[model samples]
Target: MITLYGSPLSGNTHKVRMALAFLGLPWDERLTDAAARQSDAFAALTPMRQIPLFVDGGLTLRDSQAILAYLAARYRPGDWDGHTPEERSAIALWLSHAANEIANGPAALRLARRFGLAIPEDHAAAVTARFLPVIEAHLERRDWLAGDRLTIADLAASPYLALMEDAGIDPADWPAIHGWTRRIAALPAFPAIPGWPGEGAN
Candidate 1:
């Protein structure tokens, strides 16, 4: 069995959990607090002290996006794994966007606030202002980021986007984005993280 180390409230960690569920893989979860992550044992497994470390058999992996890709490739045999060249490229593009822009922008601001980190209100506001429009524009007519079907792109982006409420950005404000989120929530085998309530529970 696989062992996942991290807090469920973490977006990065949640993404991995979601992927595992989507792929129908059973794994053990080891919950770790922020302080526990700095311990010698955890640090030995993940030098960077990041959340969502995956240990399966003899292979150990870090980085949530990489874990998601690994799960999809290992468990999903068809298009869901992005078998075609164009599909693979599209998946890479969206994954990069999710990691760089969305994660760094709105997700970072919300996490800073949640963790009681010193974050300027104006800075959070700036992130929200910039992020909403980009997401709104992309979600305008598309059912999913890559195409009509659900893919890792949706899993990679959903957790952080689901927490937009914490940033004081109402899903109601962006109809397309709101609808997209609902669709993601309705996917089969979607796992609910321990700390996070079900969709819209917050």
Candidate 2:
């Protein structure tokens, strides 16, 4: 069976869970705590000691974006992944955005606010101010972030954006982005993450 090591509160971990659900993959989740992550057993599995590690058969993967691509390519075939090279590149762009801007922006704000992380308030505010409008404008033009269909880009970026409320941001402030999230939550197999705003989404 595929094994997933993650925390329920982690948006990175939720990204993998949502991808697995979307791809119809079954996994045995091993929830990990901070102490467990530092344990020798966990360290042996992943030196980075990050949550949301994936192990299936002989393949081991880290990083939520990489894991999302792997799960889509291996299990979803032409469905969740992009088809043409340009389409794939477009998706890759958003995946990088997920790892960088989304992570540093909304996700970081959530982390700082809820978990008491050391991220600078001004920096998080600046990131939110800069990136949220970009996302809104992008969504204003297209329903999905990349390609004609939903791809890894949508899954990669949605988790953090869904938690915008937790970051002290209002979905009402960005209607297009908020509506786009409702569209994602409307997907047949979308998984719910704790403290995210998917409840009652259309």
CA RMSD of each candidate after superposition: 2.4, 1.6
The global C-alpha lDDT for each of the candidates, from Candidate 1 onward, is 0.78, 0.85
Q: Name the regions of candidate 2 deviating beyond 4 angstroms.
A: 199-202
For model 2, how does the per-residue alpha-carbon lDDT over 2-69 read when each residue is reduced to its tens digit? Answer: 99999988889988998888778899999898899999999999889997899998999999999988
Q: Write the per-residue lDDT of candidate 1 for residues 1-202, one digit (tens) a residue.
A: 9999978678888888888887787989999888999899999998889888999989999988888888877777445558688888888887987877777776777767666666666766676687778878988968887766888888888777777766556767777777777777667887765433355653
lDDT of 1: 0.78
The residue ranges of model 1 lying beyond 4 angstroms of the native Cα positions read: 119-125, 193-202
| N/CA/C clash count, model 1 | 0
Supply the global lDDT for candidate 2.
0.85
Per-prediction TM-score to the true structure, in the order listed: 0.88, 0.93
- Tell how far residue 16 is off in model 1, in angstroms: 1.0
* lDDT winner: 2
